[model samples]
Target: MTNRKIYRIALEVEAFPGMPTTAAKLLPLLENHDSTASEIESILKYDPGLTANILKLTNSAYFGIPTRISSVRQAIVLLGWKRLLQVVMTICMSPLMNKTIPGYDLPRGALWQHSVAVSVAAEILVNALKIPDADEVFTAALLHDVGKLILGGFVKEDLQQIESMVTKGITFDVAESMVLGTNHAEIGGQILGKWCFPAELVSAVQWHHDPESCDESCNLSDIVHVANTMGIMTGFGKIDQELALEHFGPVADRLGLAPENLEDMAQQTADRVKKLMVSWA
Candidate 1:
């Protein structure tokens, strides 16, 4: 894969060299039952800014709690441990996702919007279809475009060429390769692998833009691909001209989504998503 343009682009990024060490320090705490809420709270207490940010988001208009939740402990109790962990992971990666990348035409928070929307879409899809491990699916969908973080500076420099090709009706992945000699999929997978995300998730991001390539072995990645394709269709993160509809055709077939039912489901998902957009947006 080293010679592949996408993989080559990942190689150009200055990835974290001490990620495993940091993971070793923290993973055991999350993995072992010994780490309690108090322990995690104690760690957060020192970082007042972090704690405040978390609390703010928990009580934000997006979450739509009946009453205000003013503390991390209360937020944890209300949101639950699983959701809390997700929030932590989101916060930890904010620096990377929020970084400016002019090449991709992404503003400071553009990637974050896309990431979070895809995550919510994945969860919604999994729940509707009764897909297992929905949280993991949500996590993978959230980070699917993580490669953009690594390729930020590079993409900013060469986006004109990429945009030109995209305007000419070239596929997004093709445009990325043409402009940067790499694409987001390879870049995202490497970052997640280095950070010890589950292998399946890494694979989902690496292959989401191309589900057929992933179906040779299994359908896990295909699930994510469809979720993302739905997001694309619904214009979650962009307002561009018509996107290629072919990306969803075969996957919908595999998933057995009847053509007649699609429009209604899309509307339902959009309505569900709107409720939280006030706070999140």
Candidate 2:
């Protein structure tokens, strides 16, 4: 199908049921640097479902907080607005990301696993490299492959074509673009754009597969690109190995990281993902 047709279909089906209205409302507010904790708690209070999810996650084994967080206000104060927003987004998006995507050969929860892995890896990179805005990078990494959720059926439909191209040495993203008229990263960007996400986030999702081609200089896209590759390397998901390696050296160099950093980051990311999976479970 044409890209336009695929985009149309994505628009129709992209309104995932798990996306809490409260989370949607809170995104812009959280994006504002000046947004106060009270403001965040006020928005979350009205959505009991969202509040419950946040409380559950904050009190999850992943957080290791001793006392139970019974109230949204308490959770907000404990987590702070930045981390609280991350938890909120994670809880809200989990349902959609956790679903099986047979087209991409991701069984139930596989995509979510990969997403969390990348998010963890991105967080590691942010700290190690001293990159600014940890929360933004983590959020972008978590949603980087959202296009795959939208393009699963199309990827499945074009599986044979995709595999054939891969066998002939073409990368997965290229094969996807060739067969489906658009790749997941671009499709994911469009979906996030429709959700009224920030342009930087949309760019990160869109250009993650090919960060070098991004209109702007190195940014979160480069970080997520390396993180996504690390996630696949650590067995969270599948990708063309050769294609992924091509970016590894360039991205690592761009970030001034050595090969050893990636190896350590991958291990750290796996351990963190394992702990976080319990909450999702």
Best by lDDT: 2
Off by over 4 Å in 1: 1-11, 16-35, 156-164, 178-180, 215-220, 239-244, 256-277
Please provide TM-scores, in order, for all candidate models, with all chains considered together. Answer: 0.78, 0.89
lDDT of each: 0.65, 0.80
Model 1 local distance difference test score: 0.65
**Compared with the true structure, what per-residue lDDT tens digits does model 1 show for residues 127-159?**
677765545676687778877766766666666
Local distance difference test, candidate 2: 0.80
TM-score of the candidate numbered 1?
A: 0.78
Candidate 2 all-Cα RMSD = 2.6
